[model samples]
Target chain A: MPPSGIRRRPGGRSARVRATVLAAVDALLAEVGDEGLTLDAVAERSGVHRTTLYRRWGSVPMLLVDLLDAGTEDDWRAPDTGSLEGDLVAINREVHAALTAEPSVTAAVVAASFRSPEAGEALRRFWEDRYERCAAVVHRAVERGEVPPGTDPRRLLVAATGPLYHQRILLGGPLTREEADAHARAARAAAASGLL
Target chain B: MPPSGIRRRPGGRSARVRATVLAAVDALLAEVGDEGLTLDAVAERSGVHRTTLYRRWGSVPMLLVDLLDAGTEDDWRAPDTGSLEGDLVAINREVHAALTAEPSVTAAVVAASFRSPEAGEALRRFWEDRYERCAAVVHRAVERGEVPPGTDPRRLLVAATGPLYHQRILLGGPLTREEADAHARAARAAAASGLL
Candidate 1:
């Protein structure tokens, strides 16, 4: 077994191996969806042998959970746009890009979550952390008098993101940039009304 | 072969077969989540033969789609509550109940839609049809001058539903009755501001 619980490099491999494995997960998701994604395929695609892959992640579910965890920390740091609308627009755009740019990975993770409590827990934690951070932005807007003092910033943040997820899964759409803009505007407007 | 493209029971056999199959699907989903759900399991649990199951739905995806289509017509119907908020609350409550009550099925259908264009298309039809129907309730609010003119009722409706889906998938929380009420009010307030 490799030291530090990571394999694929004896002495040291750049942290790039993690990224490579994540990309493999993404690619496999795009090709096979959720039910068909397998650890062997990930190992082959990642060019990391089965032993290394197994040592790193005991099972497909564990590997997937790691991949998803990698995704969460990639770009969750939202841009500071100053204005409520500007911040929302920028964040919405970033989220929209992430979900749409890798629709397959996003969908596969969502599906896997349904079957694996570990995946579900990972997703829930990602959201809570992300939402809490995003809520800070909305709260700043309220402090600036851009929105009503009574606005539920947490709920507003969720409202801003709700449509894109809905369209992709339940509503069946690509969640385009235009759609992101519309949802942001609507969420901001609602916040301003002290209703969110 | 049985009549009407489904495996019909022998003459005078009770309609209980279909009901049993559906109940079996629901049970499987609740216990197994999406990945663990399988056609063979459904048949075996329901005490039906594999031939009978295959003759009824053709494939797992087909069975899932049919299972979704069955007994769900009344679930999506919008209520006439004389006000947009009231109507929205009703719709939101129904959705909350449905999701919380059947997380397994909800997760399964969503995951399947990711890989199957047919499932994706069916989800689209379901959303558009239900949203259009729900929009009528919002339009009624406009007629009452409760919301501003030129408001996109459809967008407003989307705002209301967007958070529920987000919270369900990301927050790991239950869709309580209180959340539904809050979403309806937020959606209405957003609409009144011409945000929709």
Candidate 2:
């Protein structure tokens, strides 16, 4: 085993290995869906040692959870466009782009969440963390007197994004830019009318 | 082979076989999820011949599609509560009950949809059909001057149900009856305010 006393660097070999492994997992998920993913395939595709992967991830679901966690870390800043409507629209647009840009990958990750308890827990945490992070936008809106003081940020965000998710994942509808805009506008209208 | 001239009854042996096969598919999906569902396993569980199963369903995805189709046929009627708000609340409550009552089955079917193109298409059709059947509620509301003429029923319905789905499936939140009522009320308020 490597010495535990050595301080790890941010962009060191360990980070590179993790990045490569996650990328391999992403590719495999896109190609074969979550049901077909295997640790051996990930090892071969990532050029990581099988023993290392087994020791680190332990199972395919754990590896998927790690991939999801890594995905959540990639720049999900709450929009601050001076108005709640602008921020809501921007965030909804971002979600629409992510879901539609790579449907297979998004679908596979969601399917994995439903099929594996570990992945499901990770996905739940991912959404909760995202909601918590984005709650600041609503807080700022409340401070600015743009919305009610007691407005629920998580509920508002869910309302803004839920229809988009329903259209893309559940109903299999075309997730157009206009649809994303409409979702944002609807949420904004509801919030302004004290409907949220 | 059976004679082509013989008329088939609705609930005859063929129907029984289909029901048994679909039930087996549902059971296996709940037990092991989409990844573990197989034609051989379904045949064994249903006590049906392997050749018959192959000839009828052909693949696991197709079998899942059949199961979804069967589910859709079981009594989904729009509530005629004489008011749009009442109807919306009733529908949302039903959605909440269905999602929470048998979460495993719902999760498995949704996962199957992500992993299979055939299942995805079937799921899409299922929602569309349900939407069509329930469009009457909105039409009645329009006729009663509750909602504006030319109101999109599907949009209203999506708004009412999207949050529940996001909470139950994506965010993994507890979908309570109060939450269901809240969703309906929010959508009703939004629609009344011309947000939806």
Spell out the clash pairs found in candidate 1: none
Q: Output the TM-score of candidate 2.
A: 0.80
In model 1, where do residues sit more than 4 Å from their true spots? A1-16, A23-47, A72-76, A102-104, A148-150, B1-51, B59-61, B71-76, B102-124, B148-150
lDDT by residue for model 1 (B1-196), tens? 4575354545334356777887888788777766676778987899988898888777767766666666445465579988888888888887777677655466566666655667656656666777887878877888999888788767778788878877775466666778777888878877777777
Q: Per-residue lDDT tens digits of candidate 1, residues A1-196?
A: 4465545564346366767887888788877777777878888899988887788788888877887677567766666788999999888887787677554666677767766779878877766767777887877897899988777777788788877777765675666798788788878877777667
DockQ per candidate, 2 decimals: 0.50, 0.48
For model 2 the local lDDT of residue B155 reads 85
B153: Cα error in model 2, Å: 2.3
Model 2 segments more than 4 A misplaced = A1-11, A20-61, A72-75, B1-11, B19-63, B72-75, B102-104
Backbone-clash count (model 1): 0
The count of residue-pair clashes in candidate 2 stands at 0
Supply the global lDDT for candidate 2.
Answer: 0.82
Docking class of 2: acceptable
Clashing residue pairs, candidate 2?
A: none
The CA lDDT of each predicted structure is: 0.75, 0.82
